[model samples]
Target: MTGVLAGALGLVVGLVIGTLGGGGGVLAVPALVYALGQDARTATTGSIVIVGIISAAGVLARLRGRTIDWRTGVGFGVVGVPTAWAGSLVNRAVPQPVLLLSFAALTLLIAVLMLVRGSSSARRTDGAGPSPGTPDGGSGVPAAGGGTSGATAVLEAPTRRRATVRRVAKIAGAGSVVGFLTGFLGVGGGFLVVPALTMLMGLSMPAAIGTSLLVLTFNSISSMGARIGHLDLDWAVIGPFAAVAVLGALGGKLVADRMSGAALNRAFAGLLVAVGLFVGVQSLLAL
Candidate 1:
């Protein structure tokens, strides 16, 4: 019965994240701990397993339609995976309430960020800021290459090399920080990734969501590896919960393509603030 309920909840959480491209594992860990009665350590471990499986499923599905910016994803994963393992190890050492309180604070911070960033996203015009066509620091749209089409000899080469490199650096840095948090906190870190990808890396909303899921897969594996010997193994919890999360991820991916970006951003911001306030208050009460 407990497993069944957890799986059902996992499905709902997974669906929200996978479709919306956020919130799946953010909600999953708490559900596993508070509602399912798993220890904080076990819940963190289980979250890694569950998030990895579900994210992999989402990535595979997304691959059918769009080319995953693999170069960026792989680059970020390189630093992210190892850091994720380190994060898991750190989580094992922290006290439960402290970890929860930290989680609450981080979530709240993400909420405020989303609200601010989302508002900015709305007011901005296509060519208003430094984007693909503005100055070097802005979007950086380069001139056409030497080769021309038909009668002329000019190749259409935008400033891909420098732009790609810069984007990759930002993505990798974000991945590393997220991995560290995941290893330390035992949460999926999607909330952080979405905002980071958007505000820092400057990816499209859908791209950020998809890219974050890919990062989550690698991060989960790393965190799980770190937890292997340090803590008690509980396949009984990890297995079924992960299976359900995979289903939810598929649903989230579908929704991401359809939902209004503004609406999603606002809704997620509200959720973050509420969750943050609740956790912050909870932490104070326990002290």
Candidate 2:
């Protein structure tokens, strides 16, 4: 019966990842600890495995379309990898109750960000421009250039797009925050990454989402790597959990195609907030 419930829950989490580009581990961690009776630390490690594998599965379709920004994604990831290892070390030292409480707080924060992003998404749908939480820093229209040769014009386009010192610093900071949370909490931080990509890196929504999956996979790998010998493998639960999630994610992509964006955002936001509240209260009471 426990396995059955876990399977069903994994399917729901998978659906979120398949359509939303992330959020599987948010639901997965709490479910593993409270619902299926696993240790919080162990659940965090398992979440890396579950969500990381599922994210890899989710990115394959996007890869075929050449929507991923490999340069930006890898650049962002390079900063994240080592920070993730550091976070795992911190996770190992934290008390279980404190960790759970922190996780609950993080979940609530994610809920708020989702609400902000959702409102922004709604506004964009109404012609407010790029998603709401992201303020367009300058005139979004590209600067015009004139040159005698077409080759020079083409060459200049990329040179103009080269990363400014400001851009590198911003990505490094963003990578640190997202990587720490991923290593400590077992989330991919797509909630943060998608907006960062769109707002900072100037990626479109589709491109941001696709690239986030790759970013998440690396974050998870880094987190999991730090826990190598200490990990207590739970194949019985993990195997079934991941298998169902993969299938659920596949179906979710199909369902996502037909869903209304605003409505989905609102609904998902509410669910996140409610779950966050529950986890917060429960963890607090246990302490």
Number of colliding residue pairs in each model = 20, 1
Q: State the displacement of the C-alpha of residue 29, model 1, in Å, after optimal TM-score superposition.
A: 1.5
For candidate 2, lDDT tens digit of each residue in 1-287?
A: 76688788889988988776666787888889888899999898998899888888877766666657887788778899999889999998998888778877876776687678767766776884554554665533344553445666686787767747667887898888888888887766666676577667777656666788888888988988998978976888888898999888777667655666555455555666776788789888898
Candidate 1 residue runs with Cα over 4 Å from true position:
126-165
Residues 1-287, candidate 1: write the lDDT tens digits: 77688778878877867865656666777777778877767777777777778878888888876525565566666788888877777787789888888988899888888888887767775435544545555524333473334223222234566687778778778889988997877767777777877788777777777877777777778887777786664666666677887887777777777877677677667767776777678666877
TM-score of every model versus the real structure: 0.83, 0.81
Error of 1 at 162 (Å): 5.6
Q: In candidate 1, how many clashes are counted?
A: 20
